[model samples]
Target: MLYKLNLEHILFLDIETVPQKQHFTELDEDVQALWEQKTQYQRKDEFTPEEFYDRAGIWAEFGKIVCISVGYFAPKGDQRNFRVTSFYGEEIKILKDFKQLLADHFSQAKHLLCAHNGKEFDFPYIARRMVINGINLPYKLDLFGKKPWEVPHLDTMELWKFGDYKHFTSLKLLALVLGIPSPKEDMDGSMVKDVFYIENDLDRIVTYCELDVVTTAQVFLKMRNEELLADDEIKKV
Candidate 1:
């Protein structure tokens, strides 16, 4: 079934996010209390809400997207070129640009959004962020009443699960196991917050996000029993 789908119809993507504020104290008193209550189970007694604040980006309510890198296959005759681009900078701007891309190009019913663990993370994160920012949800991201099969989104992690819902696979680990080049050579998701807030390096995060997108596309191709994209075939625009 995966093989039958057109590769060109899929938009592969990855995102980098950071906490809404540089420090937990920066949040208003009310929101800070909310954060503490929200992460109680995960933090337990090991870490205070402030200590666990670095990971706040994992939750849409407390975080904001910094970058969204997308890659799509464009085949010309026998040649395949994977074009990659990113929407970065301000959170609202990033969300608006991504929404525009979805509306302008990938709006058709046949178009699909593909990401590693996207169905669980990327897809919903983008949707929640858009709503929070007052940006209209694109058709691809708006899944209000669509049936499971009618939704046009693909997840590499979900595909690898193959119905074993208990299994969880990190994109870096999956890429390594699948023999595709790892996207975490420079940095992983754990370092994204520091990289963005402390170092103020949006370009670095964008590069990493784009690498993940390319790696995801490669993983999809591997699943389809097709050739993995060569480094030369990937172009970042």
Candidate 2:
């Protein structure tokens, strides 16, 4: 059962990213050439303008991390309640704070870092940015050389597969299907970078990250047979 484990051992997290814009132009010749060569063919067809920008290292210019939010389920009375928190700041500061928080509160718990589609985007991005900032990673999150099935992670997207893993759905759509209200107020994932970079509205990015985290927590709750809160019960972060 999904709820068989203690609540204290589950940590739900999500991150928002905007590719670096400035740094890519400054990539030394060899690196720049390699990047171009790697993306040359693929960029012509399969990539969206936004994806192209990210693959081109535009997010690196924004310092890699735009915002990161985390939620945890802890015992409360006969039921478990959830707590959520997020940080929006310079990439290094936010990543450092994230590291400290994990070390202080979750260093020893046999916790599973849960997210939707995190294995593909959030996990590697966090690990890369952490290394670039010289921060070591926690053991459960060390993704190097591990097969997908070997990782101690619980991606809602993967779980939704029921082993067929077909017909992947968006987080918003999945949450809606599960009767969880959409957490995003007026923005979408495609607009995250634009909102953060063009509008300079860091709060929106943080909010988006928080939304994903909470929605992900709700997914876990549903999977575990716990009673889900109504739309009115969701408090804005």
Best by TM-score: 1
Q: Which stretches of candidate 2 lie over 4 Å from their true place?
A: 22-32, 45-51, 54-63, 143-150, 230-237
Tens-place lDDT digits, model 1, residues 65-151: 999999999877899999999999998998888888888899999999999999999999999999998888888988899999999
Per-candidate TM equals 0.98, 0.83
lDDT of prediction 2: 0.73
Question: Which ten residues in a row are the worst by lDDT in model 2?
Answer: 54-63
Q: Which numbered prediction scores highest in lDDT against the true structure?
A: 1
Error of 1 at 194 (Å): 0.9
Candidate 2, residues 1-237, lDDT tens digits: the string is 575867678778998877665345555666656665666677877764444654442333233787889987654575556677897788888888888887777766466778898776677778888888888886666767978666767788877888775668778888888887665478977787678667999987787788788888888778877777555444444
Give stretches of model 1 more than 4 Å off: none
Clashing pairs in 2: 18-59, 19-58, 19-59, 20-58, 20-59, 20-60, 20-61
Q: How many residue pairs clash in each candidate?
A: 0, 7
RMSD values for the candidates in order, in angstroms, are: 0.9, 3.4
